[model samples]
Target: MTNNSIAQPLEQAKSIAEKTVYSILFTISLSHLLNDMLQSLIPSIYPLVKTKYNLSFSDIGLITLTYQLTASLLQPFVGMYTDKKPKPYSLSIGMGFTLLGLMCLAVASGFYWLLLSVGLIGIGSSIFHPESSRVAHLASGGKRGLAQSIFQLGGNAGSALGPLLAALIIVRFGQGSVMWFSLFALLAIIILAYIGNWYKGAIIPKTKVEKVQVEKHPFSARRVSISLGILIVLIFSKYFYLASMTSYYTFYLIDKFHLSVQSSQIHLFIFLGAVAAGTMAGGPLGDRFGRKYIIWISILGVAPFTMMLPYANLYWTTILSMIIGLIISSAFSAILVYAQELMPGKVGMIAGLFFGFAFGMGGLGSAVLGKLADSTSINYVFHVCAYLPLIGILTAFLPNLEVKRKKIA
Candidate 1:
């Protein structure tokens, strides 16, 4: 072959390899938005369901437990399996489960049936998150933090939308209106299938030279393990406090401020909107500065606002809640990207572990705090949860993983 011929293909391949697959990233992000919007329906309708079923706080807690348990328990295993054997089409299949769950929820005649519906939706979430996260990683083009943040921003945006949607639809029209949301799941399935095709084709065979340059971790295995444990503690702290807000904040507003359910949901929407906004900032900042510093400021910096939350008046409560959401929401993308860096070549497993632990903590926290709220009051729940952010102090113990750029062939 002529030298010019050889150079042409080499340059073409390099150009293709080097460019970020933003189309795929945005598509996957849209799917994430759909998936989480559907998932958020469960919490968004809690007050409606509680009133419909005459549920006690403990019952409400159990419902969250059931949904969260199903979502949490299987993520790591799903992630591990897919890491070894990529499942490009599984994302669509998971959305099918969510679609069915939504249908079931629409007609749920009793609380147990409601549990079954949410459990199915949780299973769908478990299947969706880890693999979709892997898709985001593949399309990152070495900008992992930015990609993750974009991906997570969709979900947060969807989460913000759910309460507003529920207020407009379910709360006004009644539970049967939940069936309308299955359209989102169907749309997600179609998008994910298209993304799956892209994923399948995008898996170019790795060259041996490319494999050899992948960086090895500098830390001992023991140190990495300990670092992971600390991250888990941070996840626990973040999610538990979030659980109180997501699961019970409406009740707090109703009890303390005498706000209508619709009004409280709007407030929840505002907080979640702040979260979506914060999520966008974290990834790019982590990419520029370093994930550890982002993690530190995100987790610890929110403590003062959380502490003040219990004492704030209605206007101040609204302001503080948004501030809390903005600060705390930044940690996850940074933390997830950081963990992926710590355990190189285990992106799926790490994503699964952290997402799974986060769901588990939120579930457990909801259940525990539900009982606490019943025993004491909703105000007490907020007062106790305000301190959970103090666990952010553990961020000091995590060893920094330096970001190293790798050349793509």
Candidate 2:
């Protein structure tokens, strides 16, 4: 080919690739943002719910438990189905379920109804993750780590926005406004999905499926189990950190730190924003170096900050909180990527287990930690939880199989 002709085609191909990548990231991030907003809004709205419904601590815990249990229990099925019969329909199906749950919440009155609605929302949350991870993985030509990280950053972004934005809406429109906000987010997501043509089967290879039995990785599976255990511990610690901050942060600042509500909110916003940025960075770094390294580093790096959280107040605490937020959250993107990669052949199932068991159990841990904090000092809990990540660092040295890229034909 002539030099000019070759150069023109190469540039065109580069442009197309870049556009496709941006589109993929945008769609993934938007869906995650919506999901996280729905998830996080509950904690933010707790005080209002308590006043209106006369909810007790146990009641609040139960409501939260409903969401966690449903999501955890159903994830395996969602994952397995997606891996086996992977389709673009997965995203829409998940969105449909989520919308139904959100609608239910919007109209709900009694506490039982609210619980059921949130449970449904959790189920909906469970359905999409594995399928989405698979799609992201395929889209990136099997650069699964980076893809997973980018995908998760979207959710973290939503998490960061949920409290600040939803708090504003709740103040203006009252508690029920949160439900309306979720519904709006739901509708927006559906519309965006259609507009982006996110349903295109770009991830699926045009090949026939054959029932093939392959040798199971008995050794790797054992290692994965151990790794899963390590993650569970890490999850427990992080969840405690998260729940403490989300559920009681403002109160803590006011009571313990002696800061005003407005100041606490500002610090909280900064902390969450840093977390979102850290999550985005973690994924690419994991992809470039290794997931294990990121996890270990995050554990080690964040521990001191978490420990310092109880001692300092005001400016120092805010600075410490930002540091803790970044260090602790960096693992999420890497961990999600790691979990999905663990069961390479069944991306959905792996996603389910990690998010379902590891992540879900972490929520439970948060509850326990919260109870412990109520009895003792929240500072004590933070210090205790810091050690769990250190344990994870020990397991970081375990062997991991490198993910191989499938060559395009």
Candidate 3:
């Protein structure tokens, strides 16, 4: 072939390769929606389970601990392993665990069985998040922040739906109705299997030594370590505050406003819906402006609303909670994308560590706050949790890695 003919084909191939794969992004996001929707059921039905089992707040907390700990502890290892050897079909296998967990949960007769069921679900989550996040990174076509946000949006939406579904199904029909959610898990497995095929095709094998060299970051070892530490602290602050809302906000509303269970759940749904809405803005804005700016605004900037939450009357409380959810929810996408950029080639490990840390914090916070609620009050828990966002001030200390890298380049 002539030079022009060969050059034309090469240019077309490069353009096709460089394009963002929105179909994969949305498909994975939908699977995330399904996966998290199933996971969210554990917390969503807490009231029903607590009542049926005659459980205390501490028991409720332990259930969360079981689920979150299993999810948290295994994620890093899974991510690390997948980094060395990409497992495209593992996502579907993870969904299978969730499907089984749902069945167990539907028939769980005692507290221990409840723990076992949730632990199984948590195992599925641990397997799903890190690898799925890596998939989002792979499909980004360089728009990493936006891709993470899109991926997160589905999760938040699923979370929002869980409370509403619990209210409609579990509250009306009882725990046996939990089995209905298995259909969601089965659907997710099929979708993830298809995504796995795409992932399999995308993998370009390389030797370990070559992979290590390609994955090297521009920052010094110390800088990357310190930055990761800061990110962890930030995550602790975010998820701890979130734990109070997700785990206890229904109780808070029922106690303070004298709203019925259904009403309380509706309010929780509204807050999470706002979270889903807010999540969409963060990634695209991070792509346009900067991740640090988005992170700073998302975490610290919501402090005023959070601080006012406990003191507000029902109407104002609803407004402030939604405001808090919207702003705070934006931080994770920026934070995840920022960490991925910090340690460039270790996308799976970074996603695993951050996601794992977030789950650990949420679980730990739930247990501690649950105990505190038993001793003090749910209102007290909210009061103390409000200060968490102040940790956002640390954002000032994070060197703008994007700018630094551009300068170095």
Candidate 4:
């Protein structure tokens, strides 16, 4: 009853755990691909949106705000709920809303509807990262870093694929076709959900959860707020550069660098590819090297290379863009991990803000930078962006971090 019986059950539990992790990772990866298409394709569609809507600079910026702001505001609440409950249902619910948003977007009649649709998409995105990440955290056991990195790479891969696929769809089919692709992705998500249900036995389940030593930092809410503030700032700074490539790089390439639309699209794809590679790489590296070091290095790398953009020729632009892509993307991995660590018990809250708010909100920064470009050289925008990472680097010195063992909760 003692030795053999215990070992048998232990081995069986380990096998089940392994299968569960593999299934979750597969599902999360597919969800990420679909989710990324929902968000990242906006940039490819920006020109179409601008032309169709006759949007002003301020309006475009606010469109970004509309999409991101709701996500940011709702994330903490969503996280709190997911933490206390089973998460796969939240994942399905989010995907359902995301699909609805995409369907609305496919036939959007006006600016208000567009904003409403994107906002809904943002809300859906808010659910996936934190909950999926928590699942990954549980499944990984002692290898959280490596596991998180692998899981996060799914997102980066999705992002990389999004722009390139959008560009192809736009070039071959038309801008409207992007919506159809999103629909296909949404269907896939539904299929994956069914698969998850069949494999796991329920979409959501009741299980006994062990009580863990939950961290109770002083003024915990305030600390979360402060961390969120710092992240928002860093996001604003980073996206000024990052979103520019997505939203307006095609325009910039054509107007400034004399590239044709097709060529500009290619360059944008290259840029997205770089970002995807960097994001995939950064997570495991962040875990191995310490998230702090990765953050500082990425920040420091930003300024000098960004400052050089104006001075460089077209070849230099390609090289520098790749370099900047590599360094700056470290933030996606490092900061996401940092924020999750910052709020250990609230993975969804952390991810919601980090992925949803910080990123979604940062969409507005593209407009600010675009406005700045109206008066100054677009190159000068990069020059300004180069220095923004210093804030992130400086924040690295703050003393509130509490790195835990493999399991966060």
Query: Which stretch of 10 consecutive residues in model 2 shows the poorest summed lDDT?
Result: 205-214
Candidate 2 has a TM-score of 0.83
Candidate 3 segments exceeding 4 Å error: 1-17, 205-216
Model 4: per-residue Cα lDDT over 225-293, one tens digit each: 776676667766676567666666677677678986667777877877777677666667776777767
Each prediction's TM-score versus the true structure: 0.95, 0.83, 0.95, 0.83
Off by over 4 Å in 2: 1-20, 106-110, 188-200, 206-220, 258-266, 377-383, 400-409
Stretches off by above 4 angstroms in model 1 are: 1-17, 205-210, 403-409
Residue pair clashes in candidate 2: 79-348
Q: Model 1 — which ten-residue stretch has the worst lDDT?
A: 204-213
* Residue pairs clashing, model 1: none
Q: Report the candidate with higher TM-score, 1 versus 2.
A: 1
Candidate 4's C-alpha runs over 4 A off are 1-20, 191-236, 374-377, 399-409
Mind sharing the TM-score for model 4?
A: 0.83
* RMSD list, candidates in order: 2.9, 5.9, 2.9, 4.4
Please write out the lDDT profile of model 1 over residues 325-393, one tens digit for every residue. 999999999999999988877878999899999999999999999999999999999999999989988
